[model samples]
Target: MKVIMYHYVRRYNPSLPHFRFLDVENFKKQLDYFAENFGFVSQSEWATWVTTGQMPHQPDKIILTFDDAMSCHYDYVYPELLKRNLWGIFYACSQPYLTGKMLDVHRTHVLCGAFEGRTLVAASEEVVSPDMIPNREREEFTSQTYRNQENYSGVSRFKRMLNYFVDPALKTHILDKIFEHLDYQVDSKGFYVSQENLIEMNNNGMIIGSHSVTHTLLSTLSLDQQRYELEESFRFIESITAQRDRTYCHPYGGTRSYNKDTLSILEQLNTDYAFSVNYRDIDDTDFVSSRQTLPRYDCNLFPHGLAS
Candidate 1:
């Protein structure tokens, strides 16, 4: 079985085009490719696979999942999926829905888009301490500490520096300051899916899952904090979906981003399966271990054979 992950799906707008934002045309093409080449798995099918160890009869089955609950998923992706009678698992950050605040990670993306060409130091100087900016020689050292992403290049390197190495409090401060400096208004309408959107999606046969409250790196947090993150987010999802067959996806889902304690917390919360961004082929070893840390492939790595 193959599980694919996506972040954003929207029409291309030059002003704020996020590198990870897959354009609507390409997204449709990818879905077409999937429909032709593989069997689509629904949320219930995924649940049964995890709980009963029953693989789908088709060898080429694929499950679709979206992270961060971007409004574009509701606006664009959802409608397209409905047209095809396909389903996707949407893991949402509860804080955005509950408090109407933009996520820090999203803030980083906004700032990066607004200040695309500026160096990290120049962009962050006003809000971040000069000492926090690593010198040219030490930049590599700093990047290494952050689990340096696979396709880290161009603006993505700067994004990684701000996302991973910088202090969270300071990072939020810097991003907020930058957003203000750019006179940028974060379009809350386009930033996240509202509760109404969640309920509508659930009613329309989509699976809603938790992506934590603050979307913080769970492994960096203490056991109790991790528990709170998981429990509170799970509760919010239950309130909306009214179902306890909970599913979760890790924030910054590196192997190091979650530990055994995180899995224990998910088990306690009655979470059925937890997805991670770890890139690997799912094998017997994955099933032998707990289902909580199932591996996923980023959409970029979809096999060549599966492409047109």
Candidate 2:
């Protein structure tokens, strides 16, 4: 079976033209495309596969998963899925809702969207300390970090500096400084689906899963920190959504995004499975062995997934 991953799904943001996201019109078209060509596995079938070791019979079936639980999912995707009687897995970060603050990772996205790369590069240099900027070449960094799309030439170094090299506290500080300098205000609370929306979706057969507390790289944190980020986020989601299934998707999914400590924590907590950004089709072999790090194809790779 194939699994498809989605992040932002909304109409064109005229104000933020550079911002990259799946267009809602295209998303509807993609659903139509899938309905005509492929079978969709329901949430119950997915749970059965996890627990009863039964594979979905449809040869060309697909499981839909939405990450970040973006407001667009509630606004556009959820109602459309409900109309078709389809279910999906939505992974949400608890900190954004609990603290009512923008995540640093998303701040990078906003920075990239609101301003041009050259402008952002200048602002990043002015806001952050000299030592914070890495000595790495832009091409080398962007080649690895953003292989799927056009290399963000000017912004790549800026992204690398904030995302990887800087300390988390300092990263947040730098992002705040830049935002202040640019006079850009991100609507943190309105950015994601609310607890009520999650509960409604769950009640209607959608699966609500944990996407960690702070949405930081799990591999960068200590073992105890990783455990707290995973388990605490899981508990928080369960309390609010009454989610019976225990599943997680890595904050920034990649091989390096999670470690042995993460897997160990999930095992101890009796998690059913986790999602990874490995980019491949899942088969019966993966069901038997690689439940924790199952791969998913990016929505951008499919027809009608990207804006023309």
TM-score against truth, every candidate: 0.87, 0.93
lDDT of each: 0.74, 0.82
TM-score of model number 1:
0.87
Tens digits of lDDT, candidate 1, 1-308: 77888887776667664344677777888877887888687666666676777766674578889999988999999999999998889999888877888988887776555555454445555556656654343465455443423432446556666666565546667777767766777776557887899899999888899999998877667898899889899889988896545899999786666888898888887778889876664554565585788888777676322211
Model 1 lDDT-worst window of ten? 144-153
The number of the candidate with the highest lDDT is 2
Cα lDDT of model 2 by residue, 1-308, tens digit: 78899988888777786687888888889988888888788777777888876878784588999998888999999999999989899999988878888778887887787788888888887888866654345344445564565535777677777776666557788888999888888777678898889989999888999999988878778998998998889888889776667889987687767899888888898888899887787877877677788888888788898643
Candidate 2: residue 138 lDDT (0-100): 39
Best by TM-score: 2
Cα RMSD, each candidate: 3.7, 2.2
Q: Name the lDDT value of residue 209 in candidate 2.
A: 93
In model 2, what lDDT does residue 159 have? 75
lDDT of 2: 0.82
Tell how far residue 47 is off in model 2, in angstroms.
Answer: 2.0
